[model samples]
Target chain A: MKKRDHKECVSALLPVKDTLDLIGGKWKLLIIISIWEGNKHFREIERSIPKLSTKVLAKELKELEMNKLLHRNVIDDFPVRIEYTLTEHAKSLKTVIGTLHSWGLTHRKAIFEK
Target chain B: MKKRDHKECVSALLPVKDTLDLIGGKWKLLIIISIWEGNKHFREIERSIPKLSTKVLAKELKELEMNKLLHRNVIDDFPVRIEYTLTEHAKSLKTVIGTLHSWGLTHRKAIFEK
Candidate 1:
C-alpha cells in the first residue's frame, strides 16, 4: 500500500532462500539424513525411511550428487558395491540437522498440547 | 548388501521429518522471516520476498494459519485490513531459522569455492 524498502533484509534472506532451494523437499533432506546416519547403499537408505520409494530415492540421490552434497562411490568388489557418502560441504549440515532435531522434538510436544 | 539395523535412529528421524514437513519450502520460512521482521499487512509481506506471486503468498498464508504457525487478523475500517503474525508455537522456530541462516551463509561460500 505504501512505498517501503525491504533491502535491509535481502542480504539476510538470500542465503536462507538458497538453503531452502537446496534442501526444501522431504526426500532430499531425509536422504542426506539417512546417509549421515550410516546408511550408504541404495536399499539401506530406502529402508531407513518409511514410505520413500525407490524411484524417489534414486532421483534424490542423483540430485544430491549433482549438487555436490554427496559422493556416489563405485567399489569394484566381488559383487561391485555402490555407496553414498556426504561431502565436506554437506557435513556442514551437522549443525542445521542438530538444530532441527532439537526444535522438532519440542515442536511435537507443543503441537499435541494444542 | 548386509543386514543391518537402523532402528536406533528412528527417534532422531521422526522429529526431523516433522520439522521438514512443517517448514520445508522457500516461501513459508521466508514469509515467517518477513513477519518476524515486522511486515504484517499482506502487501508488506508480498513486497518483501522477490519472485513470490500473489497466488503463492495467499496459499502459503492459509497453510501457515492451518498449521497454527501464524495468526490472521482482520480489522474493520474504511478499507478492511488484514494482518499476519507468527504465533508462540511458531516463535519457537527462532532457533531453527537462526541455524539455517548461519549454515546457509557458509554453504553459499562453500559452493562458490568448489
Candidate 2:
C-alpha cells in the first residue's frame, strides 16, 4: 500500500454516524445476529426472533441487503424462499458484536443493577 | 467464568438493539472516538471535532459519562476543568472499532463504489 497522509487516513474511515446509520435501526443488528445463527428463510428469521412483526422484519432485511451487510438469495420454488448470509463486511461486525457482548456482561453485573 | 448453559450465555449478551440504543446515535460513537484520540476536557474535545454543536457535544458527553464509557473528573480550581477518559470497559471497543475501520477500507474498495 502507498503511504497515506494523516488526513487521508482519517477521511478513509466510514463516518461513524454513517456506520450507525446503516446498522442503527431497532432490528438491523438483531437481524444480523439472527442470521448469524444459520437461520435464513424469512419465516425462520421471524421464528428465531420472537415478537418481530413481519413488516418490520421485511423492512430491516431489505435495508441490510441494500447496505451489503446481508445477502438475500431468492430460491425459486412454489413459495419463494429467501436465505440471508453475512457478507464479508458483515462478518467484520462479529468482532464488534462480541466486544459489545462482553461489555454487556460486565455492565450488567457492575452498572445496570446499581 | 463458570460453565454456563446456552440460554444463559445467550442471555448474557446485550440485546443488539440496546447496544445500538446506547452508542448508535449521531454523535455517540464519534464522541467516543474523539475522546479516543487523547483529547480530554470539554474544550479540547470540542476543538478536535469540527462542526459539532456545543449543545449536542455536552449532551453526548453526559450520556457517555452516564454509561461509564467516559469519565468526567472536575478539577477544582479557578476555572474548574473537566477531563474525559475512556474506561477500561471502553478499551474493549478498540478491537471492535479497529475491525470497523478495516471493513470501511475494504468496503470502499470493493462494494461502495459499485
Candidate 3:
C-alpha cells in the first residue's frame, strides 16, 4: 500500500487536535466520566476522581462549562443547589470515552502480563 | 440506574490513568499515526506533523521508544538510515484513535455550525 503523504497525515491530525485541545488533560476526561456517571454536584464529582483536588476540579469544570461541554445549573431551594450535567454536545463524547475506557483496560493487562 | 460509588469510580479511572500516563501527551498520538501511515524515517515523521519542532519531536520519540510504543531501527546503508515504526502494543490504539478521530470530526461540525 502506498504511504500517506505529509498533507494527508496533517489533515487527519487536525480534528484530533481539536478534540484533544478541548479534552486532553489528565483531569478533564476523568471529570467528564465522573459527571457522566452521575456525580451531579461539584463535591461529588471531586470525590469520584481520585487525587483530583478541589481547585483543579473547579478550574476544569469552569473550562468545561466555557467550552459548552458542561452545564452548571442553579436549583431554587431554601439553599440554592448547584448541579452539573453533560451538555448535548458533551454527550457526543460517550463513544470516545467508552473506547478509551476499554482500550485502557486492555492496555493495563497488556502492560502487566508481558 | 445506580450511580457508581467513589471507590468504583476510582477503580475505573485507574486503568485510564495508566493508559494516559503511557500515551496522553499532545503529540504522541500524532506521531504514532504518522509512523503507522508509513513515515518510516525520523525526517519523514517530523515532516508529517505540522508545527512540531525538531526538539519536541526528538523528545517525544525518545519517550515513545522508551515506553515500547515505538521501535527504532538503524538500517545498514551508506548513510545508516534510521526508521520508526509503531509497536504491537501501539497498534492496540487503533480503535481508540479511530473513535477520537470520528468524534473530533463531529465535534468540529457541532462547534462551528451551531
Candidate 4:
C-alpha cells in the first residue's frame, strides 16, 4: 500500500478498534439492549438474558457504567432499589444495534434456508 | 417480569445473540475492516493490524469466508497469488462499521476529556 493509503487505513481503524474495545463482548450489547428495552433493575436484566450469570452481569454492568453508556440510580425508599438507564451516548447505539439485529435476522434465515 | 414481558425479552434477544455469535470477537470486524480498506493480501492485512498473528488472521479469514462475508480468488500465475475480497453481504456492514467508527471517535474524545 502507498504511504497515504496506509495512513488512511490507520486513521480509519483507530476508532473502530476503540469502539470494539468498548463493546466487543458477548454480553455488553445484549445488556445494553436489555436496559434499552426497559429492564432496569438487576434482577430484571438477569432474568431477561438467559444463561448470563449474576457475576458476569454485574461485571458487565459496572463496565457499562464506567464507560458512561448507562447510569445507575439508587432509590431512597423503604426498600432500596436501583435502576439502570442508558445515557444519550448509549442511546446513540440504536443504529448500530438495529443494523446488527437486521443483519442477524437475514443471516439466520439464510443459514436455515440452506 | 410478567410472562408477556419475559417472552418479549426473549424474542428481542434471540437475534441480538445470533448477531453476537457471528461477530463477537475482537478480530472478525477488524479483519473485515482491513479487507474493506483494501488490504486484500494476507501479508497486507497482517501488516495493517499491528498485533494480529498469522495463525489468528488465517483463522479469521476462513471464518469470514465461511460466513459468506468474503470470498477468496486464486490467480493462476507462475507462483499462485491469492486475493481476498468482501462479498456484497460483507459490504453491507458499512453502516454497522461506520456507526461504530463514529461512536468510537466520540467515545475516545469523551474519555480523554475526562
With candidate 2 superimposed using the best TM-score fit, by how many Å does residue A80's alpha carbon deviate from the native? 2.8
* lDDT tens readout by residue for model 4, A15-66: 8888888888889999999888889999999998889999999999999898
Residue-by-residue lDDT tens digits, candidate 3, A1-114: 332233434555767777888888888888887887778998898877778899999999999988889899999896999999999888888788777877777776666556
lDDT per residue for candidate 3 within B1-114, as digits (tens), equals 332233434445666677787778789888988888778988888888888999999999999998889888989989789988888999999988888888787786566556
CAPRI-style quality class for the chain A–B interface of candidate 1: medium
Error of 1 at A71 (Å): 0.5
Q: Indicate the worst ten consecutive residues by lDDT in candidate 2 chain B.
A: B3-12
lDDT of 4 by residue, B1-114 (tens): 232224434455778777777667889888888888888899999988878999999998898888778899998997999999998777877877888888886666675456
Model 4 interface CAPRI class: medium
- Clash numbers, per candidate: 0, 0, 0, 0
Q: Which residue runs of candidate 3 sit more than 4 Å off their true CA positions? A: A1-11, B1-11
CAPRI tier of model 2? acceptable
Better of 2 and 3 by TM-score: 3
TM-score of chain B of each: 0.87, 0.78, 0.87, 0.86
- Winner of 2 and 3 under lDDT: 3
Place model 3 in a CAPRI quality band: medium
What would you estimate as the lDDT of candidate 3?
0.81
Model 4: residues >4 Å from true position, as ranges? A1-11, B1-11
